[model samples]
Target: YSSGPPPLLALRLFCGAGDSENLLLGGARARVSRRPKAMASAHPSQGLPSGMDPSMVDEYASQSKLLQEFVKIPSIGKAWVFTSKDENASRAMVSVSQSDLLANKKRSFLLNTHISKSSSKSVSFQWSPFPVEMSGVSAVVPSPSGKKLLLVRNAEDDDSPTKLEIWGPCQLENEIHVARSVHGSLYADGWFEGISWNQEETLIAYVAEEPPQPKPEFNDSGYKKEGSSQKDFRSWKGQGDIEDSWGETYSNKRIPALFVANISSGEVRALKGIPRSLSAGQVIWAPSSSYSLVFVAWSDDNGFQETPRKLGIKYCYNRPCALYAAADPFKEEADKPSTDSNKGDTAALVKLTADLSSAFFPRFSPDGKYLVFISAKSAVDSGAHNATNSMHKIDWPTDGKLEGSLSVSDVVPTVMSPQDGCFPGMYCSGLLRFPWLSDGRTMILSSAWGSKEVILSINVAR
Candidate 1:
């Protein structure tokens, strides 16, 4: 409205309670009417700018009405499907959001539904009567057993502490407030974000911004001595050193680091042993009794010639990263020191995908026999922003003993150029946390296929 062109009108049809396939097919036969000339003659009372096209005003009004209708329909966000004790019954929790233009924010809520299948292969979804709004919530994650829910309410201001609420089936169980001195906001942004609950559900590991670095304290008397915390009204802090962050959307963001929270004791500990030159994210508890953490680490030397330059990582799959495994900090502290000369190699951080240039979204198979992950080696090697992804698997030791070097097998190789009607390789932006099917060997994933994105059932054993 401020002298710019009208917003592009995007019309989307949503089939709420009907056969969506037939409705979509019927759309092909539907027709749209053209703009009538009479619409150009607008009401005189509605004052408009000189030389402005009257038809544009009418068109804008019409489009605005359609937008209002569309805005009423909330868009689906994250969803989780859980199987119940009864084999025929299953439940699903779907998060949806609608834009509240008046408030200049989004209103989020959860839709509960019951899914059932008949003998005739017919499926039905019984949705709840109303959705429960989740106000002031940044992220919601359900535990593996679906018995507990983790709600993250990131701090809105520097003074406010970030709140982590552990909600049980019937009530709020535990709430922990993390101060800025421990860490900044948790990374809710999809790229570097990784929130994972341990198998026991007693601990959670996630990625968060490191605590604020110390600044140089100064006063009217010039630079103050370091470590002097004397209260002086005239004393001010100076920018100590400027650090390079992942470019683009990561402006003014602190370096990402790993942290684990004990749900029972409400104790949060920042993980150590990772090199300062690397940034960690997408953390998950490894399939081990000790609960070792597996995560993706991006080295600071991501630029050409191995220089310490951080390129824009958002949507840039070419960034160099690799999977790493490190022992749990609490477990390491509790265990006695080993006298074995090889103990250092066993306890230290181990690179899981040292042979690959890029690896992420690590997931362990249901049987805990293999660790599968998607690789962007094609994008990394060719220096492309993105390319066809390849799936790889590592044979995990049954004894939970990680070796220095593990064998990696290629499950799906990159397809350079596919033929007509053939698969155009896997173009997956992200992988689900639990992608395995009932067979444990079959994995369900969504990948881009030409103009459409299609769900694929891949047999990892093949």
Candidate 2:
């Protein structure tokens, strides 16, 4: 439930930067003057008056009166927005999937919109002439600089190879073909999908099914040892040992691994030393530093035993996971000792969130002042598949030194249930890998306000 101090209180009662007025919503323009006393006199509850239409106001009045009176942004499906750290340009890449029952076919289209910063306090969006057809795309990711986009086409058949395409704004830059033996199909499901582009935009980090294990060979006479490579029709192969994956969502397959690919050279490197008992996913490139990879590793409950058993991870936030920072396999050698290891080990994996039970969706601020993340501790503790979440931030050291005892400041606390006419609670399906506005302190995210998913803007600085 949206809780505490009202979700949109900051916008309705507080004033943002600048003295000039601008249109905050579509088809409506509310003048926000510097004169606060006069503005407050009009609405006792809201210091800022609504600039939206009455129909929109009535639609949202029950959920949040203050939000209805302030701003109205349409609900979006799958979307990606990127803004340069210099704050010079911003763009949004949005997609919507549609299926036709009569035709029995499904398709998706991508719309590109340019976010214009009219002023410090004003913003607007202008859509392109037409949307580009994304016919066979399994996943779409934009680079940090917004100069390049990565599109993945997963293999529909077991014999076909997976395809990766790198595209610029107007042209296809490069393509890479990955065989099934190198790595199985890439995970596009939200929970297991882990794709990221490095700061320099030279490499990409992602998660995919690990290489298949070698099977035994057979001969016409009987079971053949490793030395025989003759085809036999009489002998049948035995079943191999089964590997366990997370219960609900990952039952069909197992073994999610971390990999890095050099876009320019077309070379892929598999990260080693990560124990087989722990499945890795949701990886991202850290800020400019020696330890460039940060990912979430989920350990099996029976890690000590030979047959490692995985705990349920799908939609269940209760499973314990910590953010791990490690050296990039491609940039650094495997034998090199990790310089930032607090745990006495030659392996490059360094645990960052040792104190938290569950942590995911890591985002470094534009200025790299802090690392912000979301925690589902309540869901884990209560044994619920999904529950309210809390937002937290760790003050990043300017000198690029990080310790285990870094103090974590709470940005948004968990709210179970709220009173009537208030925010229900935070329903963050998942935070965008990079969910930040032009200002470092302000962030825009989507969450379930009641039955409808709504967008929320929160200022961690405040």
Candidate 3:
């Protein structure tokens, strides 16, 4: 049991003009206040309506207490199922969260479960005795081998720095604190979040906020000299440029950029060659020896007008985006100072889907033979905010060579209308990181079927 102050139970009472009462229970007092006539008329009764039965208030309180108990039950947030070396056994890690109403925060924890399959085609799960609480953690990612765990704790304020902790089986292995000058908090939101570990697990590539832009500096003399680091109480910085954001939930958030961190040396570097007009997200390590990166880039010119305008992109799948590939920044730096004349072109970003208007959520096959992605071309071509989705795959070069253009093949075409009791269409929100089954050609994903959601096993080879 946790050792701290006992949980606080609060009860608020609002009375009419001439009604008042005092309640004391469990060494705590209830707050009671009177409402004015105008407010009483506008907001109605705080306990019961004018004509409603007073006994109903007691019933409501009883139901509210039941809801509080229900709220205490944690909800599953994420789950990962791993196959064990033993043929019939497996392990699963599930992240669960509960709302702390007293503290106005969310308490998250991880639970471990062991699964075993029997010859009778039955399955059973054995849960651990206690859960491990993850306090103040923004994200937790495990390496491919499950030997290393990465925990991300984002800064809560401007003065604080983001912290990354790497934990081994027994103890904490490494802790890295990133200053604000390097980059802002990493994007934990699933939309722009893309944290991936390479095959070797020595490096990690993810999406985060770009470094803050330079602001206009001024002093008592008016307009401080350029590149001057003079420090004085009179000198202040002004907002240099007012840039438009993706709108809605993205307010005050910086443009999402690509970054890579060397877990061994604790060095982080932003990926180069991406254009300023595009924002990157959902990055993944390409199946190449050089460790190339593939990501989705959204253009800023997504407005209805001719000029560039930043539109709300949270759930609007119609936003024009395309998948692009770029060489690893570290590899580029290592190969610099070479006499190759085509270095510029080789280091530049290459568009993987030049023909499709919308492509995202790129996933490589288990064998790295094909790169499959979801397309919202119907939504982009039409003016709809969302529409039926289609699945497509590109034959990745076996030699890890990227060309100017690659042929795209459609696995699942968008179905506008369906017959009675037939397959409607694919309305997918997102895909699991590893959606493939034992067979390398089949993929399992969830899609919307009318008002209900159902899982489908699609064979990309078809």
**Lowest-lDDT window of 10 residues in candidate 3?**
1-10
| lDDT measured at residue 450 in model 2 versus the true structure, 0 to 100 | 75
Q: Which stretches of candidate 1 lie over 4 Å from their true place?
A: 1-46, 49-59, 289-291, 336-347, 417-421
TM-score computed on alpha carbons, candidate 3: 0.86
Report lDDT (CA) for all predictions.
0.85, 0.74, 0.85
lDDT, candidate 1, 1-462, per-residue tens: 324332221121232323221223335734344345476366442477753445567767877888888788899989999889877889999999999877978999999999998888788999999999999998999999888999999999989998999999899999999999999999988888999998899999999999998898988899899888688999988887878889888887899999999988999988876776898999988887353888999999885445578888989998889998888877776673766544433457888898999999999999888889999988988888999999999998888887558899999899998999998999999888899999999999999999998998889888
Better of 2 and 3 by TM-score: 3
lDDT of 3 by residue, 201-235 (tens): 88889898888888989988999877887788988
> What are the per-model C-alpha RMSD values against the true structure?
10.9, 19.3, 9.0
Candidate 3 lDDT (Cα, whole model)?
0.85
lDDT score of residue 344 within candidate 3:
43
Worst 10 residues of 2 by lDDT: 1-10
Candidate 1 vs. true structure, TM-score: 0.86
